[model samples]
Target chain A: MLKITNLHANIEDKEILKGINLEINPGEVHAIMGPNGSGKSTLSSVIAGKEEYEMTEGEIIFEGGDLTELDPEERSHKGIFLSFQYPVEIPGVSVTNFMKASLNAHRKANGQEDMPANEMLKMIREKSELLEMDRKFLSRSLNQGFSGGEKKRNEIFQMAMLNPKLAILDETDSGLDIDALKIVANGVNKLKSKDNAVLVITHYQRLLDYIVPDFVHVMLDGKIVKSGTKELAYELEERGYDWIKQEQL
Target chain B: MELKDKLISSFLAFEEAFDVDSDIHEVRSNAIKEFESLGFPSKKEEDWKYTSLNTVLKHDYSVFPKKEDALEYRDIKKYLIHDIDTYKLVFIDGIYSSHLSETTHDKIDVCLMSSALSKSKYKPIIDAYFNKIVPKNGLNSLNTAFSKEGAFIHIHKNKLADKPIQIVNFSTGNESALMVQPRNLIVVDENSQAQIIERHQSLTDHPVFTNSVTEIFAGKRAIVDYYKIQNDRASASLIDNTFVEQQEESVCSMHTFSFGGKLTRNNLNFYQRGERCDSTMKGITIIEDKQHVDHNTLVHHIFPNCESHQDYKGIFDENSTGVFNGKVLVEKEAQKINAFQSNNNILLDDKATINSKPQLEIFADDVKCSHGCTIGQLDEESLFYLRARGIPLKEARALLMYAFANNVLESVRIPELKKRITSQIALKLGVSLGFDL
Candidate 1:
């Protein structure tokens, strides 16, 4: 479902992602665990077409289409989603309005008519209940004055609403409590299907305990250094990233 | 050079052509003398530093005659409130049109000040409050000396008005530059309460200039809520001056929204004279293209134990410019007075400009007063967050801009007026954010 070859990216002439090559198939879950400066977040941002990162070399292909050439909205219309580390707080727009705009934009790009308001409202209610979000939450401004856990859950709620083909969870577990982690993990698990893929990016194994990965890749200094089963996450948590660095050296 | 001489001679011609009443003639003569002494304020004047009155002074604009042309009411239906009936007062080209105005309430008295001045019952009220609140400055002097006609509204003592009062000012001319000055004096008697909505609109696409002055007096323990909506034509220029005074334990509040105009200036002054009185002032301006909107507010706390609060915000796009100046003063005996003021602005384009100054002068040390101002662009991180959620960049920008300006709009209490202002603001944002509304 996704492929990256020799991905070299920089921000303002400072190299962040040196050389990265990765591939993931449909129905597969891949976990990329790295320390603070390992370019983990940069990878997600570059793939999502953030304007800050300058792609110097290499290309990204999603579902047999060149993803590097698309704008952020085009990438989104092509079913690429990035759960931000810190979700933005848009002051005047209600969550329902934002969700409807996004859904309609995607639907229009996919040659489908706009969703009816009644059906959209019904779908939002069901999803809010599933995510344990209050109905009033949809009426308030988008993420304005929201708690950390609430923002994370709202991100997951939006993901459920959009139902993208490829989901990249970037540091989604950094601010979640135990209960929120479970709820988010449950939402992801419930949405899993044979035709979609999930890439969980984190530095700790705590989130892995809830949504286990089919393959685990340890990333250090902008390159994937090792690949193993889910047990590798537990091993890294026990021994820390230093053991991986020593092995690479 | 010819245009400048023509503009100056035009004012001189108006002085000789019009015949004023004996008592008002003296006032107009004095005002004309004052205006000539000050001439037109240039950039040299500290108060007019950022805004230049050169364009207005250089243009040879014509003054509306006493009975030159008839005016029609075309778009008056859109501003009517459904829930509450109101006494409608209409003014066209600065002249009150009684034929087009209607009033059903018995307690409320609505009449043209020119006509009311002739009546013995309203003479004292007009003499006491007319031109009393505005300072004897060049701008105010020009408005007083050249005003064609105005409205006079008086609420009886201890009367709680069940309906609001609406004042509609319209300007109509074809290809001819016309100047209209409509003055309004409102007095809510002791223990009375009322609401007023003042709307300024233009009928033709011709270049029109409107200089309006409204003075309000909230009597002892009375309450007044006032709103000023300026939706003039794109070719029109407006300079609106509003003065509000409060008596003992009375309350006065004003909300000014500027949506369309070539160049708009709103001067708002609130004076808390009586003890234990309070006042609130809020304003919002949305500018695009070469439009310039300047808002100047002053709140004076003369008596003891009075309070005031002010908040103004502006959103500028294209090559537009906005200016905000807020001043709060606490007198010597005004101890325990609490006043706060803030001015914030957002610039959406690289060339858009904003100049904000929040001034506070306190003679009483025990008073609690604070003032601040901020000018900035949209948050980049917030923009990225919205884009990541599948929202296009343009839509994301519109959402953030709407949120930033919503704080001022939420303070408007009247539902119909609030909705109108909100929709107008939304339309401007849609254009600035590169979205088709």
Candidate 2:
């Protein structure tokens, strides 16, 4: 469902992601473990079409179409979702309103009529319950004054609402407690399907235990150094990225 | 007569007709002389640098007479409150229209200044507070010098009114340039509470100007919520000044929503005189297509332990201009005062402009005061977030702008007024943001 060939990106002349090659098929989960400043987040951001990063080299293909040329919204309409490392707090915009706008935008892009308000409300209620989010949270301003765990769960709730084809979870488990991590993982697990893919990017291997991945890639110094099965995540977590750095050297 | 000559003649006519008494006639005359000295400010004036009042000043305008045009109550029935059983006051062309107004509460007295001019019971209150806070300079003095008729509302001591009072001021023209000055004085006595909604509208599409001044006094422990809605015609020019004075432990909240006008200026001043007094001022202006809106707010904390907050936002599109100047003053004795002021604006077009200045003048130590202003466009990330969800770009922009202005509208306490303003704001966003409603 996704392909990257020597993807090189940078911000303001500083190279972040250099020659990153990865491939993911449908119904598969991939975990990218990297140390700090190792371009793990940059790779996800470049794929999500964040304009801050300049693509210096290479290309990305999503679902057989060139993804590098698409705008962020277009990529989003193509079912690409990025759970931000730090969710933005948009004041005065309610969660339900934000979700409805996003969903309707995607539908409009795909030439579909907007979902009826009643149906949307029902869907939100069901998904919010699944994510263990209070209905009142939907009425409050989007992510304003929300706790870290609540924000992560809200991101998962939005993912469930949009039902993207590719869900990229970036540090979703960083600020979450054990209960929140399980709830978020459970939400992701429920949304897993044969035609969709999940990319979990994390610094710790604990998140991998809840949402087991089919493949794990160790990233160091702006490049993916090794690719293996889920066992690699445990190995890296036990021994730390210092061993990976030595191997790269 | 030439344009300038006609303007001078109009000023002289107002100066001749003004009823100046012994106590304040000197002050009023001095104000009139000052008005004559300064004349109508052109674009050259520092304060009128961005806003050109030449259209209003150069026009051969006449004042609307008190009994010239007869308008019925049904002409403005759409804006009246049918559900709430309360006092209704009507003013046409700045003159109090007794035929269109109705009052129910005995303790709450609502009467026209014309009637009060003849009666003795409310004469002292009217004389004491009328045109008291409006300074003798520039547009305010001109308004006072040319003022014709208005309403006087006095809530008796300790009288808790059951329903909010509604004031609807309408300006009508007969295909000629005309000016209407509506002066109001509202005094809420000790331990009293009330809500007032002041609505201004135009009866004709022709060019009409309304210069209004309202002075409010909230007594000890009194609470008052004042809302001003300006939805005039595109050809109308509005200059509204509202001054609120709070006594010991009194609370005052003012919300001004400016949605239409060729050029509109709102001056809101709050004086926190007594200890533990609280004041909040919020306003939102949505201007498009050559329109200009200016909001100047000042919150003065004179006593100790007073708190004040001011938030104003503007959305300008299609060569429109918005100006916001918010000032918070904490006196030397006003220690432990908490004052915050913020003004933010969004410019949707390259030609659209916004000038926001937050001024903090604190003379006391151990006071918390902060003021800041932000001028920018819509967030690109948030826009992308919405568009990615399948909402079109136009709808997404409108939604974001609506959310931006919703911060101010949510502070309105009256549900009906809040909903009405919200729908109006939505319509404005739809029109300005190019989204189909």
| Residues B96-142 of candidate 2: C-alpha lDDT, one tens digit per residue | 66788776548788766555544667669867777777655567776
Best by TM-score: 1
C-alpha positional error of residue B226 in candidate 2 after TM-score superposition, expressed in Å: 1.0
Chain B TM-score in each of the candidates: 0.91, 0.91
Could you give the fnat of all candidates in order?
Answer: 0.58, 0.41
Question: DockQ of candidates 1 onward, in order?
Answer: 0.49, 0.34
lDDT of 2 by residue, A37-72 (tens): 899988888888887899999989998999878878
Model 2 off-target regions past 4 Å?
A: A56-58, A110-113, A242-249, B1-31, B41-50, B65-86, B95-101, B203-205, B431-437
* Best-matching candidate per lDDT: 2
* Runs with alpha carbons beyond 4 Å of true place in candidate 1: B1-22, B66-85, B431-437
Per-residue lDDT value at A198 in model 1:
93
**Model 1 chain A poorest 10 in a row by lDDT:** A89-98
DockQ of 1: 0.49
Clashing pairs in 2: A102-B389, A104-B390, A104-B391, A105-B390, A105-B391, A106-B389, A106-B390, A106-B391, A107-B390
